[model samples]
Target: MLSSLTPIVCGIASLGLDHVKLLGNTIEQIAWQKAGIFKHNVPAIT
Candidate 1:
């Protein structure tokens, strides 16, 4: 079992560009995917 909405800190360092770049994914799209892990009341450092 996992705790949901526990207000944990999340940090995103980098999104692999060289690999996924060939897939035709835009930088904004990749940023969104990385930022999607953020939750309300949680501190996220990108």
Candidate 2:
């Protein structure tokens, strides 16, 4: 038998105002951009 497991990972310690501004200056926009790094249907604990 074979089994698979996915481990939780953390990236970008923090997203500063400058970074958010570069991404369009809104929390929602920044979140959308950062969310691009993860796979679809996977649980995220932000």
Candidate 3:
């Protein structure tokens, strides 16, 4: 699952309650989850 995505640049197309089921509760939680895509020392563009 994108294991080579070292310098992950997730230019999120959009965000909404559509994935509420998968994201669990709270938007902050969802953001935190998505943010896990980042690398330990690498930088994220967006």
Candidate 4:
């Protein structure tokens, strides 16, 4: 359902925003968090 999808979308967006905010302090952590946000088999640059 659309309601169920909302949390998934919000989680992905949160990971991305958190990754950016953490970049200045920790590059490795950002990499891990970013990987969590991305989908496998899909090409992305971030």
lDDT of 2 by residue, 1-46 (tens): 3236553553543555567656868777777787676755555555
The pairs that clash in candidate 2 are none
* lDDT of all predictions: 0.71, 0.61, 0.63, 0.49
Off by over 4 Å in 2: 1-16, 41-46
TM-score of each: 0.60, 0.45, 0.54, 0.34
The better-scoring model by lDDT among 1 and 4 is: 1
Global CA lDDT of candidate 2, please?
0.61
- Stretches of candidate 4 off by over 4 Å are 1-25
RMSD of 3: 4.6
Per-residue CA lDDT of model 3 for 1-46, tens digit only, reads 4577455453443455667789857777777777776666555655
Global Cα lDDT for candidate 4: 0.49
| Candidate 4 pairs with clashing backbones | none
Error of 3 at 42 (Å): 1.3
Which candidate leads in TM-score? 1
lDDT of 4 by residue, 1-46 (tens): 4364333332323333345655534666665655675555445553
Best by lDDT, which number? 1
Over the full model, what C-alpha lDDT does candidate 1 score relative to the true structure? 0.71
Candidate 1: give the clashing pairs: none
Which run of 10 residues does model 4 get worst, by summed lDDT?
A: 7-16
